[model samples]
Target: MTQSKTWSQRFESALHPAIARFNASIGFDIELIEYDLTGSVAHAKMLAKTGIITPEEGDRLVEGLEQIRQEYREGKFVPGIDAEDVHFAVERRLTELVGDVGKKLHTARSRNDQVGTDTRLYLRDRICRIREKLRDFQGILLDLAESHIETLIPGYTHLQRAQPVSLAHHLLAYFEMAQRDWERLGEIYQRVNISPLGSGALAGTTFPIDRRYTAELLGFGGVYANSLDGVSDRDFAVEFLAAASLIMVHLSRLSEEMILWASEEFGFIRLTDSCATGSSIMPQKKNPDVPELVRGKTGRVFG
Candidate 1:
C-alpha cells in the first residue's frame, strides 16, 4: 500500500517533472498568495482567541505569515515544484519557518474553504477595480459623445444603412452598455464578500471556533450559514465570469465598429499613432490593432 508523503516527501515511484509542470498552478495562482496569507492570519488569530491553540503559538504563526508576506512582497518567495499548489507551497514554507506549530494552522479549515475565501477576497478587489476602469472608459465615451453631438453618421441595420443619426447617439448607446457592466460588477462584489473560513473539509469543525469573529477579521460582510455550500459553492465566480463575458461582448461590438470606422472605405475616424500600428509589408496602412486586440481577447475570455 502506498502511504501519503508529507509536503517535502517524494512519491514512492518518483513523480515526473513533466507531469508536475502540467498540474502546477503556482505560476498563476501564486498571485493568490496575498489573500491566502491574509486568510491564514485571520484563522490563526481566531484559533488562539477560541482556545484551539495557545496564544503563543498563534502569535508565532501570525509573525511567520507576515514574514512570508514580506517575502512575497519583496520578490523573494520561491515556490517548490513538488509542492502541489499555492496552498501547499505556503503551508510548506510556514512549517519550515515556525516549526510544528505552523501545522496547527489548518486544524479548523480545509483548502476547499480556504480557496473559496481567498478567491472571494481576491475577486472582491478585482471586480471593484474592473468596475472603476469601466466607469473611466464610459467617461471617455461620454467625452467623445459630447464632441460628436453635432456630427452626422449613418446608422446601420443588417449591414445596410437604415437611418441618419448623430454620432453622439451612436456613442451614447455604448455608454449605456458600460453602465450596465458597471452596475453588474457592483452587485457581484456584494455576493463575493461573504466569508467561508469556518467550513472545515466538508462539515463544520467541532473546535468551538468563532466563525463570526474570523469573518469580522477578514472584513467579510457575513458568514456562510451552510458549511457544505460554503466549501462547494462557486456561484459567485460563475456570475462574475458571466458578467465579464457580457462586458466583453459589448467591447467586441464597439471594437468592430471602431475597426470599420477607421477603415479606408468608411473614412469616419482616424486612430492616433500611439494606438495604431502599420502592417509590416504595407507602408501606407495604419492598422486598428488596439480595437482588434480587444476583439481577439474577447474570444479567449469567452472560452
Candidate 2:
C-alpha cells in the first residue's frame, strides 16, 4: 500500500480535477519523453566524465532512463497528473525506479535549459518531417504540371479572368512557392539545432559542464554560447511560425484555384467526390469543402 499523504499532497488532492488536468501537459508533451531521456542520459554521462557524479550513479541513471524509455515505447507507461511536463515526469519515474541516485541526474541543469533543449530537438525533428511532406507535395504539383503541359486555363487577376495560361505554368507556380517553403524550413532547422542543455536557469552553472559534449550527444550542430541567450531565445519558434505562414499562404492560393475550378461558372476541372461535399438542401450542389476549409485555415495560420 502507498504511504500516508503529506499536507502538500493532501492540499493538491483537494484541488479541482479539471484544474489538475489543465495543469498536466503530459497529454501532448509526453511525446518528448524519449528526447528527455536521451538528453538526461547524455548529461549524466557528461557529469560522470567530469567527476561531478560517480560513474556508478551515471550508469544506474542511464540504465534506468533507458528502461523508462522502453516502457513508454512499449505502451506500458502511464504518466500521472503529478508528473507536470516530460522532464518532471521522466525524473519522477527515474526516482521511483532507482531511488536517490535518480534525483542526482539533474545536478548541473535546470528545467529551463532542459525544456529548451528538448523543445529545440523536437522542433528540429518536426521541421525535417515537414520538409519531407513539402517535398512530396511539390512533387505532386510537378507531376500535375507535366500531365497538363499544353492544357490552357484562364489566368485570373482580381478574381476576373484576365488572360490564358498553360495549366502546367499555373501548377509550376505552386511548385515554386513550395520550393521556397522547403528552403525556409531548412533555414529554420539550422537555427533551431543549437543546443541549450548547459544554460541552467538564466545563468551558467559552477560545474565543469561540457555543453559541446551534450550537444554532440543529442545531434545538435553546436551550443548556444551565452547562457541567458540559450534559456530565453525563442527565435526558432518565431521562425517556425513564419515558415508555417508561408506554407499556409501557398496552400491557400492553391485551394482558391481548386475552389474556382470546381465551380460551375469556372468548370475547368472536376474534383473527385472524395475531396468534396454535398449541400443538405440542394441535391445538385457539390461543395469543394476541403479547399474551402484549407483556405479558411490560412487566416488562422496567418494570425
Candidate 3:
C-alpha cells in the first residue's frame, strides 16, 4: 500500500506513532472489510437511486470496491497503520483507484454507522454458523443416545448418586441444554439484523438518505428507529457475549463430567487415545486433556 494522508493530517500536527497505533482499530476491525465493502456497494446503489451521486460515479465506486474486495479475498490488501480502521483503509485505496469520486462514498455516512452496520452483518452471519455447528453437536449426542438406551448410569445430585438412569437419559440432559443455547442465538439474531448505515456520525446525515432502501439492499430486517442508538448501541455485542457465556458454561459443565468420568478413581469412562494425553513419566497415566482444556476455555470466555 502507498503512503496515504492520515485523516489527522488536517490538524497540522502528527500524533506520536505509538499513540496513533494505540488508537487504531484496524488490527481487529480488518475482519469487517468484507461487510464494509458489502455495505459500501449497497450504499452506493442507494446514493445513485437518491440522486446523491451520479449513476456513473456509483458504478465506478462499485467497480473500485469490487477490486478492493477481490484484493482482500486474495490476501493482497494490506492496511497501513495510518488508515486507523478497515473503513479508512478501504476508502484510501478506493480513492486512489477511482480518483475524487471515491470521496463521495462517505457523502451521507460516518465511521460510527459503518462500523455498527459491518458488525451487525458479520455477527448475523456468524450466528447462523454457530447454529449449524450446534445442531451437528446435538445430532452426535442423539446418535449416542440412540446407541446407549439401556446402558445404566448413576444419576447424581450435589455429588451424591441418586438413582440408576439410562445413559441415553444422561446425554439427553446435555442435548436439552444445548438446544436452549441454539434457541438463544435465534433470539439474538432479531436484534442483530437491523441496519444502521444512514446514521451519520452520532446523529444522522443532512442529505436525504433512504434508510429503508439501504437496509433492503443489505438484507437487514429494518432500519434503526433512533440514529444515535443506531451508531452508539453495543447491546447486540453485549447480548452475544452473554449468550456465548451460557454456551461456554454448558460446554464446561459437560467437560467437567467427562473429565471426572475419565479419572482412574471413577473409571466410568475412557477417552480415546486421539484425545487423551499420556504423562511423560507415568506410563499408566492417560489424562483427559481435551476436556480439561475445554473447562479452561470457559474461564477465559467468562473473563
Candidate 2: worst-modelled 10 consecutive residues by lDDT:
1-10
What are the clashing pairs of model 2? none
Report the lDDT tens digits of candidate 1 across residue range 1-303.
222334436545644567666777887888899999999999999999999999999999999999999998998987865666888888989999999998999988888889999999999989989988998999999999999899999999997999999999999999999999999999888889899888988798888999999899999999988999998979999999999999999999999999999999998999999999888898999999989999999988798
Cα-based TM-score, every candidate: 0.93, 0.89, 0.94
Model 1 TM-score (2 dp): 0.93
Q: Model 2: how far is 283 from its true place, Å?
A: 3.3
Off by over 4 Å in 3: 1-5
Candidate 2, 50-77: lDDT as tens digits: 8999999999999999999999889887
Error of 1 at 131 (Å): 0.8
True lDDT of residue 31, candidate 2: 83
Q: lDDT score, residue 293, model 1?
A: 97
Tell me, by lDDT, which candidate is best.
3
What overall lDDT goes with each candidate model?
0.90, 0.87, 0.91
Shift of residue 274 alpha carbon in model 1, Å? 1.2
Per-structure clash totals for the candidates: 0, 0, 0
Task: Give the Cα error of residue 93 in candidate 1, in Å.
Answer: 1.1
User: Least accurate stretch of 10 residues (summed lDDT) in model 3?
Assistant: 1-10
Candidate 1 residue spans exceeding 4 A from truth: 1-22
Query: Which pairs clash in the backbone of model 3?
Result: none
TM-score pick, better of 2 and 3:
3
Model 3, 1-303: lDDT tens per residue?
233346655665667777777778889889889999999999999999999999999999999999999998898999977888889899989999999999999989887898899999999999999999899999999999999999998889898999999999999999998899999999999999999989999889789889999999999999899999999879999999899899999999999999889888777888899988888999999988888999898988787
lDDT at position 283, candidate 3: 95
